[model samples]
Target: MAAVLSVYLDLALGLVVTFLLLSLLVSGINEAVVRLLSIRSKFLWAYLRDTMDGAGPHGSWLPTRVVDVFRTMPFLRDPRPAHEARPAPASAGEVPETGTGASMINLLYERVREIDHGKQGRTSIAEIPPARFAVAVMELAAANGDVEGLLARLKQMGSPLYGHLKGVWESAQGDLDRFRKGVESWFDGEMERLSMLYKRYAKWVLAVLGVAVTLLFSMDGLEYAKTLLRDDAFRASVTAVAGSGQGAYDELKARCTGAGDPVTCVTETLSEPALVKLMGQALVSVSLPADGEPEVRWNGGAWWDRVSTPSHWPGFVLTSVALLFGAPFWWDVLRRIAGLRSRR
Candidate 1:
């Protein structure tokens, strides 16, 4: 029985490994496909531009829509005369910069006004037009000859416009910083999520395989049952009924094993009423022993006896570890999958 169980267990382990590997492969393929399909050259360019602008003394967070638009337009990234970087005209301050920075400052003021009636359109450091502000900085830069001194003066001037431009520039810098942080966070989160997902998948496959192993291992119990059926005492009882040489056989034939219950080895032997009565009398004379005393059969001998075996300890430890650690991970994955499907 133990040998048979071991064979089944080994097969189950193999199946579990196969399933786990398959799940990992599937997940990897899915990740790769998503990466491949999401090749956003335009988005990359926009990101780079935003990065550059932020790095410049005057850029802010680009709008999500701008990112989306760039993603949709493949040629947007390609260099063109219009797209080429041109130095801001020293006098372009009169014309408003029309993009993320301007839009964000406007949006911020609008939101602030909505929340505070008394503070309606309060001049924030974010609203100074970049070009106008850049000209101011250039003038400061030319006057001071030292970029650091110019920056320091701008920081010291403390006018609402100066403050707003500085705030906007700082805010842009902050946003770019945040984007870098977000990228790192996202990569870490994604890698962690994938690892957890794989571990969970592995566990679930192992569980199903474990159940199958248990079922296969229980097959030995069926064989034991068969052995019980073929016991000498059971056969003798059946033989004695057959020996009752009379019409008993015909009558009791219909009463042999009612409903084919293997536990009760009796079978219908006759159909005739008189013969059935005779067969019944003969069965009564054949007395079988009561059920044998219950026994606990250990596969690897007593627990202590098998503890010293190298295979026994490792197998036991691994199985225990798998069950203890793997269950929660598996449950989490199932929950996540359920959540994802629900969203869909």
Candidate 2:
């Protein structure tokens, strides 16, 4: 019974470690693709337009005078081109800024821009907090004295923005604070839906990256498990490496603290160099089939025979599916399995 349990532990630990390494590689590649394409920014921009101007086909959403306010906001009014680097912030109490920077919308755009591109500034802001966005919209709606007057104007103009503000006003029961909170809640709900769509898109990216990484690395999930179970020396080496890396994993986890977005946290935490180093450590335990000669000779056997008898499709699929679970899931499993083994 003890011997069987030992074999099981070895197999589990080795497989978990392997999956964790593969997850890091796939995740990093996916993040790179996302960054290159500016996927998050695109999604956020689309959401902003749709929410402000009602759902419609892709194009500029500035039809109404109020909606055009987005283009005239403090940040948007800069004469400098979009590609130019933003000027450094004013030093101490000295204010040499040419633009009147008293807009909350400017602060929100700057904050979101910083989050998306680090210190770099871009014309397009990726993320807008629901609370800030709601406040900005309310301010725009009430630009001329009161919301009722704006709603009267909005009705004449047949603007979609009127319906959104009217609903919030009715729900607020005449309380100004309640109206603001209601607007925040409404925007927050929309953002939640956007988050779901973003996650769905991310899953597709993960699936593609997972398969590519599996094929490139020759990671066959079934074959790896079989090898670990059958080869005691290799299994021990993998288990040892996996166990010794606990401190590194813990440190990485610590660094992920206060990362508001989970996906961003993962991508930034397992950076390119870190992923390469970890994968290198994991690969040192066992050689992949790609590192070896073909088991079936192309000249000796028929092409169909070679393809059918020694095909890696099943193994590739298995590994790819395993990687979709991501690194954090496998890391937790590794920790639990290690604890179980230690207790025995």
Candidate 3:
């Protein structure tokens, strides 16, 4: 019984190392992606812009549009802002500078006014239905008197949303009916584009993180497996514990996917020195001379010597490729390997 337990303990310890390596790689990749692209900040900025500029019956959080209040006319207030009284120079030619700045709030304000009042600033533009947008794109289109000019202005605005709209307009080919369809179709494509962008960048980030983590921990999965298999003493120890049958395997599986955190649960049970010992063995087992000790520190000398050894390259490549398969894959493998005790 003790021999069987010892054998399983070794396997459990090995699993702990794998789990920590996976956790480190995944988390490190996430951090790098977020830092490199500021994904959260950009997401928040877009959310706030949409909320503040809301035009639906349920949205628009600000009070009274432009606060047009009089002794008797508070409810009859104009939707224009107080700044509307001055607007900006050549108000005809002056559209809001609402891109990539606090001006989006100001842009949303102007848009609300246009929606409430009219598009053309007169009955003609007003008669056109209120198009849904925070920026006065329709007003700009009306003011420019041509869809082409408005599309140009949208591109120059530097807002990704508006740039998307411009793309919609261009694809419509000057037919108003086609333009409406273009807008809808373009939106769906852009949504897909956003998803693909994340996946593409995430893989790049993950690869970088995997390399860094592999080096830091000196993990070489193929080499470790080879050494463990060849070591009759080590193999016999684990096989005995594994012979305890289904119940023991189930227990190991539970610990691998432990309640709080599989990685953390395993880590807390293993010592730092124990892990270092395992990693160091994996890193240099091939070159390790019969007279030499396996307790070598990871350094340039160790790496150079290991790589220069005749048989270490395949093991090194295999280890890197195993890591590329990611944590979930190995976790499943670990569970299956543990469950094998019952079948035997």
TM-score: which candidate is best? 2
lDDT of 1: 0.35
lDDT of 3 at 79: 30
What are the TM-scores, per candidate, against the unseen true structure? 0.20, 0.60, 0.42
What's every prediction's RMSD, in angstroms? 22.7, 16.0, 17.8
RMSD of candidate 3 to true structure, Å: 17.8
Candidate 3 runs further than 4 Å off: 1-20, 26-30, 36-185, 230-232, 235-276, 281-300, 307-310, 332-344
lDDT of 3 by residue, 1-344 (tens): 89667655665557445654665566666777564443433332233234333332343322222221111112222232233433333233433444443234354344444424322231111111223441244444566666676555545654345555666677776776666666546544544554564455455556656665555545555566544443434334334446865433443444356356755544543323344444554343323433666444446577556656657657555555556666756766666655633333
* Per-residue lDDT of model 1, residues 92-198, tens digit only: 12112332343222222222222222212222121223233243444434455534343354344332233434444454463533433443444345345444533
Residue 87 of candidate 2: its Cα lDDT? Answer: 39
Error of 1 at 40 (Å): 7.6
Model 1 alpha-carbon drift over 4 Å, by segment: 4-8, 24-28, 31-35, 38-50, 54-344
**TM-score: which is higher, 2 or 3?**
2
lDDT of 2 by residue, 317-344 (tens): 8889999999989988998877754334
